[model samples]
Target: MNSTFMLDGEEVPFTPGQTVMQAAAAAGKYIPHLCWHPDFAAHGSCKLCTVKIGGRFATACTVRAAAGQEVDNHTPELTHKRRTLLQLLFVEGNHFCPSCEKSGDCALQATAYEMGMLTPHFDHFFPDRPVDASHPDVLLEFNRCIMCELCVRASREVDGKDVFALSGRGTGSHLIVNSESGRLADTDFAATDRAAAVCPVGVILKKRVGFAIPIGKRTYDIAPISAQPAGDPDTGNKLEETP
Candidate 1:
C-alpha cells in the first residue's frame, strides 16, 4: 500500500519523494497552481498553491508529502488569499482579457474565475511594457506576463533553447529574450518551442492564428479549469489540438 496523507478531509496516496501537489495531482485532486508543471521541478514562486499543513502555511508544490499528515486545502482563508494573489497578478499586468487571444484558454484567467476574483482590489500598475513583434512566427506581448518563469524553465530544461529569461527584481521583474538585439527574432526561439507554449497568460503567442479557435469554443470555455483532470500537465492550458 502507498503512504497516504489527508487533504481536505480525504486520504490521498503518495509514493516516497512526491510533493503534496504531485500526490494530490496523482490522486485526481486539484490544487490551484500557476507555476507548477509535472514535467518540471517545483519552483514555488506562485504561492497560489499554499496549503495549511498541521496549521502552518506552505507551498504545496515544494512541500513533500508524508504519511498521516493533515493538509488543509480549499479552505475559506486560503481561498481568500488565492483571490488576493490572483487580483494582484491581474492588476500588475495590463491584462485586457476580453480582447486577449488567450482569453478562454488562459490558465491565469480560468484560475482567477475559479477563485471568484470579481475585481482587482489593488490599484493597477499599468506599466508600459512594449510588445515585441520582431519574430515572424511568434509575438511577444509583454503586457500579460505574470513572471511565472514557466517559459524560462521550459526553454532551458526541456527544449534546450535558453531563449527566455527573467530580469529585474521585485515589482520590476519582467521577461526578456536571451539575445544581443533584445528581440525574439534574434534568438533561436521557434513557434513550436516549449518556451513559446508554456506561457499561462497571453504573453508568448503565435502569429497569424490569433482567433483560430473562437473565444467560446476554447479549452476553459468548454470546461472550467478545476473540472479538467490534473493528468494532462502540458502548459496547464490546453491550447494545442492533439491529432
Candidate 2:
C-alpha cells in the first residue's frame, strides 16, 4: 500500500494503482465525471473530472497521487473550464434530451446542471449519426454519445466482452459496435449485457423501459442532478435518488 494524501482537502489512503477520483469517492467527495466509473477501468478521456493537482488542471480519473500532494477540489478556474467543457460536449454530440428516454437520470444532464452551464457557446455540429435498434430489447442512438467510454470500458473490463470500439479519426470520430456488423442486433448482444446498461445517455436504452416510469415522475423530473446525492455502492451508482 502507498498511503494517504490530500484529496479535496481530506486525507484518504489508497493503494498505488488507484486513481485520484477513486480516492476522493472512497472518502465521500463526489467529483463529477462521466467516463470514470468505479467498476470499470479509468479511461480519463472525458476530461470532465479535471482537478487542480499541484497548480495545473489534470484529469482525476487517471492521475495517481503521490504522498503529500495537494489537490484543490473547488476553484473558479476549474469551474469555468468544466462549464466550457460541458458546453463542448453538449454541442458536439446530438444530445436531444427532450425526445430521449434517459432524460432525468442521465449523467450528462446531471453534470451540466451541477456545473451551472446554462448555454452552449459553440455551434451545434448536428452530426448525421445513425441509430441501431436492431437488438431485441435495446436501442442504440449513437447521436447522443459523449465519447465518455463508459460502455467501452464496461464491455471489456466488467463483462469480458469487447463489443464496442471507437473508430475514425479527429473530428469525425465515432463509436462502432461489434465486428463491422454496423447493426447492434446482428451481434451476440443480450439485453442484460454490461455495455447496454453502462450507457450514460440516450445512446443506449432498453426497449421495454422506454415510457415505463412516465415523464413527469422521471429521474430528472424529481431532481435536477445537483440536488441528487452520490451513488450508493450496491446499485453501481445507477441514479438511485429519492423522490
Candidate 3:
C-alpha cells in the first residue's frame, strides 16, 4: 500500500515532498486556499487553507503530507472561519460585485460564493486606491487587489521581470509597480506576461475588452466555484511539456 494521510476519513496518497494541499488536490479533494501557486513556493499569507492535523492547526499549503497523519478538512468550524475571512475580504475593499467587470471570471468573487458568503458583514473600507491606466495595453485596477501576490510571483519567477511588489505593511500594504514613476507603463510589462494572466481578481485587465463574453456566459457563471479546477490554476500539478 502507498503511503497516505487520512483526509476527512478518505485515504489521500502522496508522493515524496508533497504538501497536504498538493496531495489533496491530486486526489481531487477540494481545500480552500489562496496565495499558493504551483509555479511558485507556497505563500501562507492567505490563511484560508488552515486544516487540523492530529488535533493541531496548520496551513495545508505549507504542511507536508506524511503517512498515517490524520487531517481534518471540510468541517463546520473550518467552514465558518473561511466564511469570515471571505466576508472580511469583501468589506476590506470596494468589492461592488454587481457592477464589477470580473463578476463571473474573478476568483475572489467565486471563492466568496463557494464559502457561502451572502453578505459583507463588516463596514466597507472604501479606500481611495487609484487605477493605473498608463499602460497602453493593460489596466491595473488597484482597488480590486486582494494582495494574493500571484502577479508578483509570476512576474518575477515566470516572466523573469521584477515588475511587481507589495509595499507597506498591514492595512497600509498595497501592490506597487517597479518603476520610477510607480506606473505600469514605465515598467517592462507586456500583455502576454504571466503577471497579466495571474491576477485572481479583476485587478489586471486588457484594455477595451470589458465583458467580451458577457456576464451570463462567463467562466464561473457556467458552473459554481467548486466546479472549477483546484490550486493556483493547476500550475503546480501540470505535466512538463517536452520542448
TM-score of every candidate relative to the true structure: 0.96, 0.87, 0.93
Score candidate 1 by TM-score against the native.
Answer: 0.96
Q: Report the poorest 10 consecutive residues by lDDT, candidate 3.
A: 234-243
Clashing pairs in 3: none
Error of 2 at 226 (Å): 5.9
Which lDDT tens digits does candidate 2 get at residues 1-243? 558888667787777877888877776677778777778667788788898888877888888867887888677888888899899988988887788667666778777878888888899999888788788887788998888777777788777778788988767889988766688877777767777777767677777556656666766577655444543322222432222
Worst 10 residues of 2 by lDDT: 233-242
The whole-model lDDT of each prediction reads: 0.88, 0.75, 0.83
- Residue pairs clashing, model 1: none
lDDT of 3 by residue, 73-150 (tens): 989999999989988887777788899877777777777888888888888888889999999999898998889999
Error of 3 at 30 (Å): 0.8
- For candidate 3, the lDDT comes to 0.83
Better of 1 and 2 by lDDT: 1
Report the Cα RMSD per candidate: 1.5, 3.3, 4.2
